[model samples]
Target: MYKHLLVAVDGSHTSENALDHAIGLAQGENAELTLVNVANPTEYMALAPEFLQHESYEAAALSEGNSVLDEAMKKALASLPAEKVHRHLLVANKGVKEMAQLLVDYADEQKTDIIILGTHGRSGLMHLLMGSFAETVMRETNLPLLIIRSDGEA
Candidate 1:
C-alpha cells in the first residue's frame, strides 16, 4: 500500500488522467498526495534570442509552473482534504539535469512511496526526437511507478 504518492502534472490531458488515477489510488490507501510541477528555465532560454534576459525567461517559466500546480491542486482538493495534499513547484536547470532526474530527486527527498505519471506513448521518430520522461524516470528510480498511457482513459 502506498502511504505517500507523488503525481507530476503539466496541465496536459494525459496529466489530468494521471492525476485522476493518483487520486483514486491515494483515496483507496488513505495516502498523502503531493502534486509536483517542474519548471525548467533553460528550456525557454534555449529558444530565447540573445537579447532576452535569463531572469525574464525564468520568471515566465516559474509563473507557468505555478499555474499548472494550481490547476492540479484544484482537482486534488475535490477528492482529498486540502491538508492531506501538498504542492511543490520545482525549478530545475535543464542544462544540469533533465526533468526525469529532478522528479526522481524530489521523490527521494519527499520519501514518496510511489510515483504516478502519464505517457503520451510516442514511438519511433517522435519518441526519439522528444524523449520519454516517464521511461527515463522508471529507469532511473527504484520506487514503484504507475504510468497511465494517453488512451482517453483514466
Candidate 2:
C-alpha cells in the first residue's frame, strides 16, 4: 500500500535484512524505494586531533557511506529497476542534529509512507550506552516503522 518506501542502510547484516524486506514490500506493492545512509562524523570528534583530523574524518566517513549506498543499490537493482530505486548519501550536521533526527526529517521531506530500519537489538548495558536509532525514530516520527532485528536475542 506504500507509494514510497524509505530504508536506512549501513552495510551491516541488520541493514541488509531491512533492505531485503523493503525490496520485497516495494516489489509487491509496486512502490518506489529510497535508500538512505547517514554518515555522522561527530563520532570521531572526541578522538585525538593527531590521530584523525577533522577533514580526514569527514572524508572517510562520507566515503564509507557512499560505499554502503553503492552496495545496497547494487543489491536493489537485482530485483527493481534503476528508475524505481533511489539513493541518498546524507551527512549528519555536527553538533546541530543527531542521525536519527536526520532520518526522520528526510522521511518527512520525502513524504515517505513508511520507514524501515534494522536494529542490532542491543539490550541492558550496551543498549543504554549506545542507544537505539530505530527506537528514537519510532518515538519521534508519526509515520509507520518496520524494525528488523539482526538477532533474535533481543
lDDT of each: 0.88, 0.89
- Model 1 C-alpha lDDT versus the unseen true structure: 0.88
lDDT, residue 78, model 1: 95
TM-scores of all predicted structures: 0.89, 0.89
lDDT of 1 by residue, 1-154 (tens): 7899999998888999999999999899999999998887776766647656445888877888999999999889999988889999888876323788989999999999999998899899998887888999998899999999998553
Candidate 2: residue pairs that collide: none
Residue 108 error for model 2, in Å?
0.8
- In candidate 1 the C-alpha lDDT for residue 45 amounts to 64
Give candidate 1's root-mean-square deviation (CA, Å).
2.9
